[model samples]
Target: MTTPDTQSCTACQDLERGREQAAAVRDRSKVTDFHVLIARHRARHPAADEAVNVMREQGPRT
Candidate 1:
């Protein structure tokens, strides 16, 4: 099965766009900006659900 990012979906494109925006403003990104980026990324890429869910279950990495 194709992953969301590899599927060339709109959301995936949006995520890439977001990343670009973040990179463009890297020095200005605040805590809230990071949170927003993560939230948007998760919202746009449901196909990542399996991996994300598994990670959530596994807890934070050291």
Candidate 2:
């Protein structure tokens, strides 16, 4: 049986992983905000900026 402490510890580990990945991406490319990443991707990938902006406007859900 899983204890509440174990559940909390798992949640914290998942959150830490997410944060670490975000940090790694930012450190590798120097982009933090989603919108900035979208813009950079658009420039490099030559995708539509309007489409990227729309996706970016979705906020944290992106």
Q: Say which candidate scores most in lDDT.
A: 1
lDDT assessment of candidate 1: 0.62
Q: Give per-residue CA lDDT, model 2, range 27-58, as digits (tens).
A: 63432444354444435434344556877898
Which residue runs does candidate 2 get wrong by more than 4 Å? 1-8, 27-62
Local accuracy of candidate 1 as per-residue lDDT tens digits, 1-62: 64544465665566556767767777455535655765777675565656668788889776
lDDT for residue 14 in candidate 1, whole number 0-100: 65
RMSD score of candidate 1 (Å): 8.8
* Number of backbone clashes in candidate 2: 0
Q: Candidate 2: which pairs clash?
A: none
The prediction achieving the highest TM-score against the true structure is 1
Alpha carbon deviation, residue 56, candidate 2 (Å)? 44
| Model 1 Cα shift for residue 26 (angstroms) | 0.9
In model 2, state the lDDT of residue 30. Answer: 35
